[model samples]
Target chain A: MTPRLTAFNVVSLTLGFAFLYLPIVLLVVFSFNESKLVTVWGGFSTRWYAALLGNGPLLEAAWVSLRIGVLSATFATVLGTLAAVALVRFGRFAGRTLLTGMVYAPLVMPEVITGLSLLLLFVALDVDRGFWTVTLAHVSFSMCFVTVVVQSRLVTMDRSLEEAAMDLGATPLATFFQVTLPLIAPAVAAGWMLAFTLSLDDLVIASFTSGPGATTLPMRIYGQVRLGVSPEINAACTIMIGVVTLAILAFSIASKRGLAEPGRAEGA
Target chain B: MAEPPGRPAPLIRFEGVTKSFGAARAVAGVDLDIAQGEFFCLLGPSGCGKTTLMRTLAGFETPDSGRILLDGADLAGVPAHRRPVNMMFQSYALFPHMSVEANIAFGLRQDGVPRAEIAERVAAIVRTVQIQGLEKRRPHQLSGGQKQRVALARALVKRPLVLLLDEPLAALDRKLREDTRFELKELQARLGLTFLMVTHDQDEAMAMADRIGVMEKGRLVQVGAPAEVYETPATRGVAAFVGDSTLIEGVAGAFDGAAARLRVRAALGASSPEFVVAAREAPAEGSAVTLALRPEKLRLWTEPPEAGTPNVLEAEVWDLGYLGDKTLVRLRLPGGGTVRVSRLNASRRPEAGLSAHQRAWIGFDPADAVLLTR
Candidate 1:
């Protein structure tokens, strides 16, 4: 049975969407403003976007952030997938509860505390905190998110496929590589994308771990905001939002068309 | 069924094979011999250890005790991957991501067979299974029957010494299941491969198997030809599990080798308190025993059989169902229980001249009933 769309539902839906998207819409609109003042609409122009292209420090920081996102997401995907497999397929083992807790604790832990503890650990280890440290921090927290996404997929996977592979004369390692890995590849890809986005969006953790020559896009944006707000900042935010949105849409369409059936994922 | 000429020696043997999971025994000491080229079915209810036994043979489960022998070679340390047995899982377990051809070729590829040979064999098996044009389709695109054939093809392409089928027809619809039952039997015979199938459907086992092993609670209770198991069950549990049987509890009275008598209280009316049950062998006098009789073997009469009727009881029709080909009549006996008698509708009229609440006489031959001392 289809539910009736009442007036209250329509009103509530409209209000909820407006509350969620109004700030982003205003920022996108103001990014095209001709005036130096961000709030005032002084006719549409692309001068702020042009000025953003010439900003070397902000561009360099963005490049650094992109590299970090890609590297950390790759590492996190591997680690998280292993953790998920161990949790779901290993049945019962020693320290399983502790390992599961560690895998998920970062998801709910306060960012400041995670960042502080990571920084303190790096200090105690006498390790230099720089781009590598920032990547490590991103991997640590985003790995938890990846673990959650992949674990849910692994839990519902039909174990019979693995058994069928083994019964067909594939060894355990071969069966895992040929059957189980390919079956869960889509979820792993999704988790990687999620980790990438999380790393790109992080500011607090990056701030704690970053050292000289390791300023990320978020740090640069924050520094600019501290000096004074500009249309250039709004333009940069709009570009970041656009890139992330485009990435998500492309990922979804690619995934959906690659395998029409939700029950199975074919490796490309 | 006649044994195929030159029946090969036993292909698989289970000697005191027992497997347990922590505290519960999944497969108790099961000793069975399945000869080469024979189709054997393990029939049982759910969780009766039939699947577990099949799994052990397929090397998915290691027996806690006892040795599983294949062609006189003991299989103790061999894993499933190395076993010369292929299983068609009940769920089909087709790699959903792969095409039908890839799924069929997977076993050969895993064995490192040449690509040309693998393709040639896969093509031949697909054609043999009559799934020619479906090679390019994924499992999700195929119907239930088609998926079943794909699973069959995949298992058969390996050309293992024995093929294990776990409820092979279970996922198909009733009509499809009946059709595939015959097809699977024909395929097994044509390929000359020993087939060990596990199923709970008695009709499937009866229609396809040369021998059926009935399992109950992790134990092989009875093993025989389908006709033998159906006609003469060894125990009360096997009788009830194998088919619809009406068990009458009674006390043994007369003792003889050819025939014995049991004093059973009739189930329907209050008039007859004592009834005589003819059995092949007598239990000790005054000992409790049960009499098992099949429904189709029973004959119902309007008034009563002549005084010479051996196992006759006066009963009242309790309920009736017209099943197109046959009419099922439930009768209430003298001692307060119900027995179902199915009669073929061999006449033009649908009714069997019997209605509910009508007084009738239900009787069977003395040899039709079996005495159960359990």
Candidate 2:
């Protein structure tokens, strides 16, 4: 709280940000390199992006990853949101704590273990490893991320809002759909985005779960990286950065648009 | 959805209802009949189950036993939306995603109401709450007062059986909350809707409700007109929770049918005041008792009183607390306790007859104290 302490706090925060994002900045810069080798910037060019776009297998994998990411993220958001609501509002019945613990397991467990375990379970069930299996793996972890985000949001949301709706003529179901769900909409959106990002970035689980021809973008990237680092990978990283940046900017803009007036600065 | 105001029946009734959270009972055997056009208030302190009572009426919680009747029918197992009641949340839970108009119309839309009808009703309620021009604005852009109005509109547009307010004015500054309290009272009267409010603020409840039901630790201790409850609180908890009081423990000394009298011994140490009561609900003498005396009732005099002061005591001026309108002189009685005597500062005399640590006497009329059996 003192001036020196405040200065120190700011300095530490600045260093933290730099440490996390400096590599991404470097990655973006190198993404425009004309040369095949990412280590040397032979010249400024968009040829890597062109190359990234042209590779048939890479493009196919990226498309598959996008579909799986979107699907799994959607699934996780819906199920996670329901689970979060149930845990916070209804602290009843047996196994409540155990159920909550299970929901949070994937958030802490090593990804390799989860992937391997899920892979074994699928194999035992005679479920072929492919797009569906990879999606299942992503949802397993992505759901935990979504649940944590949504649960915190639900816990802080005014419980009276739901009551208010019911008192006004809404059934509990009506209150959930109208009042509770709308109030938690921002949290759901945030969770969805987070799940999508995590699913898109996942490699090990996808690798363990995927069958032939179902390789995800991360899997394809991992396979390519084994051969050697290339500017094409840098181009892919730049695209990822662009997507996240756009998302953050859009979220801020949306929040600002509704409450533009000064007198209504209260949280919705 | 908040039911629009044209319903033909009383909105909500709690018939011998009770609620318990684990071992802690929050609402116990409450039987309340809320009239359709009445503004009813549940007044209590924190953990008194006023909020829980409100939640039960809203259908967020089911009663452990008994039934909640709405519009002359049992609302058993009915979800919140199926019931025709809306609430104005304490925090004013406006939808962050939607504009004011959209938020107001949320319930209507969900009920499959016509779009035109929703728009018209939204506009009407928004105008009623005076947030007309700001219909396009979202909740975050609104001030505390504006958000409250929007919440009111959202709940009112549906015109449900009852509009439940959970400490609606608690978040605002003193000035804003005071103004909004009046506005809410006025709106309730004008609409003639069954307005059920849950609040810990006694002043707000007294200012607004046709009748105030004081809850204590999940039970309705007393329900009456504000004056009746103030004149005679049914229990010590109600007296203590409602407002500031000087509580003195006593024993029931004597009683005749004409005027039952209580001999209450003061607890502040020195000597106790004989609580002279016209009538009270207390057993015979030698019973432990308590009495509540309002601060304004006690008269302070610097000069010693002539012997006729029936319940009088010598006191040393311990502390002097000054308000703009009145000065409170806290006097240490002959007994270890202190009595607060409030006097109007009509004349701004610099050393106005009394100062801190001065010797004094504080007394009250015979009827000033109420005997509490507890």
Candidate 3:
């Protein structure tokens, strides 16, 4: 009976996995088809993927998105990490709960609302809403997500490590750079990756906030998909899938190496 | 190790320091003087100001009143990082992300020490703590004992003026804690640093500290060598906390030199010695007092022993526990409360004496009991 239950569980899990993955599988498989229609599966061809590389404007937009993602991710990581540390490590303060709520509130708020508010704020402040505006929007929203991720890791962190560093002649600032920051590096990296993904996939915020000459890859894709269904968008999506998969793999491998490398908790 | 570097005063001193959390005073006006190279322990029950004192020393909490002096420097405003002290957290608190080498070198690097010097010091401290060959491994790969050793190494690597340990052995198992107590004592001696350890466990404090400070209700009740604290606790709190003891409170009616007479009336007073053992500096006659006797000092027998034994009380044997080397007998005294008496199992007599519902007599020498005056 136990074996039967185990077999049943495994079968259910397999079906569940297939249900979630089947669409993505079909998308990848159809990307190679020579047919013009998305539903038809024709003979395989590398023409679309090849076309993806040669599309000058598409590649340029992708480059713009990547640059924005990298910059926003870095900025968000620093700000979010500091906010997380302040929430978790520092002593009790009167505004602590309110501050933490504000940091994490954006994670669940409507993206359209954030975009609209940000647009209004920028206009009121007389700041141009363009590539930099979109970048700022991504950073603003991503900061909260990054803060949540890092805060979860920080909450589980042993405060004694920081105290140990403090006791060993390291100031609070020094402890952050030496013990606390190094210890939470993997979480920080993970947060950055999450921030980058959020920025890369962003559309609503960018659309609401961006001006001319600030077309990101998502914005470009949105324009193409709006005009009509095309193989080019599918090709672009396939390339993204490859890049994200490779990134996740690289990150996972590096993190596992770091985990295996430390035999003991040392300072921070 | 080797006591780090010293100035010309006690490594750390608490001068009438008090710490309050909201409405509760966790540490109340504690005055302490810790000598250089002293393995001092602040011991008490939970929430009894021992950890509070340690925290004040480690700069985790600033005292609400009075000052802290470290090596003759007024440290009232000195933060934990600026203080010439380090603390090994009870959780080990090893950095989970960095390699052991990086963790050990973290403080040194933060202090702007050359990378070579940090490496050298890390290696030296790690070697001293015997955590070699595991410098490249993350904390998850290490065992609990190994983690504790690494923590010790980290705290000592920088050679702080004082090393604070907050219940360092509270996380370990019983057998492991017992074994590590000796190791910790040996480590403190070898390092010769002023070690201030906070623990709720009396045995751990007694085993590890050259001097033990007993705290109760946010007050430092007594500070002395382990034997001094154990043999003659200054208060009922210390007596009951530092070790298992039978306490009997009564008013003293008469006193004569080393012996005293009391108007006995507490629970288990009937089972107490016929007379109280007065200390050299006991309170005035007719004052209320408490008498305490350790379990190891009391002897229990199946039947009343010989005459002229001085102190004897009839009791009903209720429970029994046989430790390999000793036997603990719980006797329900006729005076209402129960008392435990531990006897060494030198021979097979304990087996013969061990029986429930048996009548027994508990006796101890007058010198074995003490009058607590706190």
Cα lDDT listed for each candidate? 0.88, 0.80, 0.81
Q: Which ten residues in a row have the lowest lDDT in candidate 1 chain A?
A: A259-268
Query: How does the DockQ of candidate 2 come out?
Result: 0.36
Q: Candidate 2, residue B254: CA error in Å?
A: 4.4
Which prediction has the highest TM-score against the true structure?
A: 1
Query: Model 2, A149-211: lDDT tens per residue?
Result: 778777766665565555555666777886677666767887888888888889888888999
What's the lDDT for candidate 3?
A: 0.81
TM-score order, best first, reads 1, 3, 2
Look at candidate 2 and tell me the lDDT of residue A184. Answer: 68
TM-score of candidate 1 versus the correct structure, residues matched by position: 0.94
The value of fnat for model 2 is: 0.51
CAPRI-style class, candidate 2:
acceptable
* Candidate 1 lDDT over residue span A87-168, tens digit each: 9988889999999998999989999999999999999999898999999999999998878877877777777788899999
Residue B108 CA displacement from its true place in model 3, Å: 4.3
True interface contacts reproduced, per candidate: 0.59, 0.51, 0.68
**lDDT of each residue in B1-374, candidate 3, tens digit only:** 13446544677879899989999889999998899999999988899888888888888888889888888789878888777788888887777767788878866776789978888898898888888899999877787888888888888887888988988888777888899999888888887888999988888888889999899999999999999999888888888887888887766645565354333333454544345454566476667778787888887767679988866787899888989798788888786788888878898665774688788888877678787766
Question: Between prediction 1 and prediction 3, which has the larger DockQ?
Answer: 1
| Model 3 residue A63 CA deviation in Å | 2.5
* Model 1 misplaced stretches (Cα beyond 4 Å): A1-7, A250-268, B1-9, B258-280
How many residue pairs of model 2 clash at the backbone?
41
Clash pairs, model 1 backbone: B266-B334, B266-B335, B267-B333, B267-B334, B267-B335, B267-B336, B268-B333, B268-B334, B268-B335, B269-B334
Q: For residue A11, what is the lDDT in candidate 1?
A: 96
Each prediction's number of clashing residue pairs? 10, 41, 8
**Chain A structural similarity (TM-score) per candidate?**
0.93, 0.86, 0.89
